[model samples]
Target: MTANRELDDILRRAADGGRISPEEALLLYTDAPFHALGEAADTVRRRRYPDNIVTYIIDRNINYTNVCVTACKFCAFFRAPKHEEGWSHPTEEILRRCGEAVDLGATQVMLQGGHHPDYGVEYYETLFSAVKAAYPDLVIHSIGPSEVLHMSKVSGVSIEESIRRIKAAGLDSIAGAGAEMLPERPRTAIAPLKESGARWLEVMEIAHNLGVESTATMMMGTGETNAERIEHITMIRDVQDRTGGFRSFIPWTYQPENNHLKGRTQATNLEYLRFVAVARLFFDNVAHLQSSWLTTGKDVGQLSLHMGVDDLGSIMLEENVISSAGARHRSKLTELVSMIRGADRTPAQRDTLYRHLKVHWTPADDPTDERVVSHFSSIALPGGGAGGRTALSVIDAQ
Candidate 1:
């Protein structure tokens, strides 16, 4: 078949670490046999990371404010600005949360949230500075282009300067939180109020040029066509080709439990795994591809290591966003180590920069850190923690 020849060529080129076009990527993503695709992708992964180590980071996703202006339909985490139930965590409260995370062995704190109307560059500068001052060792992996654009507009400055000010105030790296789909159709359909895909990449380009590295992310299963998914990867690859600032690319499925989109157009587990493999094959320039255990459950996360992922993502000590949307998966540090080992790869704890801190070779020598549990369920926060975490601050119904 003509299709078979095209796919065969594509897989050969891909396995050889050669670049494939968007069209070719789509063909492989949709048409190739699952096992065949996984084989090529795993080859690429081994070639890229030959160390045979599967990595994970210990961090806390601190949502500074649930009050947001650009309310995406797929979000159940954010409350509209001025809504009675909306609230922002005071600076000290955020610091306390960070302190708790630090005490529990978190080296990085992901400060992500809704675009609060009042928080501009200065607001972030002060917060980031304080977090760095209090815990100079904590990597402030916070904010992406969407928040940069919002803060720039709020402060009446350019995005470059916004990044400059935040970086100066100790924003060590950026988190690719707001890049929902990157393509116009699915992006607008889900989050019309957010910045355009081009604009997101533009801001990241500026960040990359400024020596500030960042990770990129995608939220799939939100009614996007296979072609659109490939388009998203292509857009990211083009940007990575120029800047080389994206440290990793993370793709997660959209949860439809409590969001406005309401379970209408979610990607299946098969599609998620396929994209993970396709991303590995496509993003040859990017160094790391992470598998999301939070959204897709543990089995897929383990399988992703064999497919294409070198990183198991963060052992989130505190996560409210995805948990709010009904992602209930959780694990401890030992559990994660076991998962990686079971996948036939050495388990390692990595920093924000993907530098391995500790690598385990033998199962008998595995770590026994009881304190390093996945704090998603039984988080030590007040108001009953993440499992029953309602809101950091909520207003009276009146």
Candidate 2:
């Protein structure tokens, strides 16, 4: 049979509740027509989430340190230990950001940064504890596998102990940030200094066993083959089958600017949509599939909603890493809701843990007329101004 026929057969079988073999999944990823794949995946999404609405979260990404020991090739955000601009935010700085996030109506704070050498489990314990003490209601959804391994090595503590200490301090959920590429060969090629692919999953498994749930992410278009992509999802699906601890699966394109991999480009919209559809079809054990608006533009993000993505990731109050890598698309609560409604889906505001906080069926008739402001960094705000800078910067400059 032709590749298209085979993919159709496999998708039909999957829709009928039968499992598709990995070989068939490879064909679906490579040969299936875009609309066909999206339609089939949309069937699955509708069956799972009968409501015709997409969701997003109000959150902020607070990078604790730009000083990283593992200089991943695809990362434009990390700086070496002795780099002139390399810096680590003190606990006070982090808390201040958390305060800003809360004030901006952010429900979740994603604390991510490079793996610093001197900072270990104790650093996280102190930081998380302080954040929780200040903002008890904010969800401390932070960290990734790379940091987990580094913490274990630096502190001479076991992975379980590291997770336990962080959880005790205030980490409610873990963000699967360091999972750029999960296949051993491709992962090593892209981020050799980081933990091995297997080790990344191993730490996540340990965290899951210890009652910490995390979202799984895959950074595609990093020179990995279609087979490698399947392998990445298969690995996460297998782990989810065992632990059932992954709350969602998020796959985004690799940004290729200001990094070692500067010559490369991100995956095309078609390729990204195919991956999102395949993720929905293959990972039955994973509940949510999130579309990356930060990496992909709003149009692609809306297309993803039809291709089986239930979540639109986040309205990140402040996201520096991807911005540093040259991702320029920005969204606010008003714009995000309009995009979801334009796609014939309801727009619901969700907390970090996928709990629906507010659902909007109609677009915001009048946009918020609050005074536009700029942060010290070049963050593309909803109203076309920078945001998140300290008042001191403005005063000192004057």
Candidate 3:
């Protein structure tokens, strides 16, 4: 068959609810026409959502520490152990942030931070228990595979034991944060000290076995090739087929600002949308495909809704890691709703696990009564800017 016919056949098969092999996915990524891919994927998206409407969630990303033992090359957020500016938030401060998030109508808190030394599984248990105790309604959808690996080591516990302890303490789900590039070579090249891609999946599998669901993510626009991208999604899809524990798939561009990979440009808007659409088509088992407005701008985000993304990510009451890496796109509750509505979709506020909390069909119908504003707080560095203090605040209105 010709290339166009081959692409058409793959799209047809995918649309007819058949799975695409990794080789076919690679061809679609490289050879499929942009509009053709978008149309095929959008068809699948409509079949799943059916409502011509997209959605978004409102949550806070609470980074509890920046002091990291594993130094990933593509990261601008983590600080080295002796960097003088490395730090961890006290448990009280973490609770205070949780209280603030709850007050702002945030139903979910992404408690992400670097792999801090000496912070064993007990530390997370205490923090999660305290947060849940104070705000039982707030969803603690936080941490990732890398942190789990580190905690297992620090506490001398098994990965299963560590995950169980944290879940017992109130971790609702694991955030797929450290999945920078799931293919072996690129992941190792960028994050040498981090857990292997297989190991990361192993942790998620263990969490899934423990009845904890997670969202799978891929850090795109890095140096990985097209085949590697498909490989990443295929790996996740295989796992989902077995465990059915992954709730959504989120692919976002890598911010190449402050870290060692500074010379590389971030993925373009077109590239991001293409991946978003392809993910919808490829990951047939995963239920939700999220459009990341945090990395891609709002216009691209809006476009993605029709292209295959159903969720527009979060309001992000607070986000520091991506911002520190030079992602500047910011959206308020009003603007987010407006974008979704403008695209002829209904915007919904969701919890960490993608459960629909509230749906805003129109601008006049928004349920959030709190004012939105941005906070300005700093993360203390031991020596001071390389290890310098980085202050971050959330956009809130009150």
Which runs in model 2 stand beyond 4 Å of their true positions? Answer: 1-5, 364-398
lDDT of 1 by residue, 234-282 (tens): 9999999999999999999998877899989888889999999999999
Ranking by TM-score: 1, 2, 3
lDDT of 3 by residue, 246-356 (tens): 999989888877889894756778878888878888888999998877777789988998778888887776777877777777766777888888888887877776667
Residue 144 error, candidate 2, Å: 0.6
Q: Looking at model 2, report the run of 10 residues with the lowest lDDT sum.
A: 389-398
Tens-place lDDT per residue, model 2, 1-398, is 23566677888876555667777788888988777887878888888888876888877787777888888898888878877777777777778777876777788988988888788999899999999999999998999988988988999998999999999999999998898889899999998888888888998999999999999999998798889999998888889889998999999888777888884656888899999998898887888999998888889998899898999877776777877777877766667777788888988878877777887756653235232211223322233234444322111100
Which candidate has the top score in TM-score?
1
Candidate 3 error regions (>4 Å): 1-3, 367-370, 373-398
Better of 1 and 2 by lDDT: 1
| TM accuracy, model 2 | 0.92
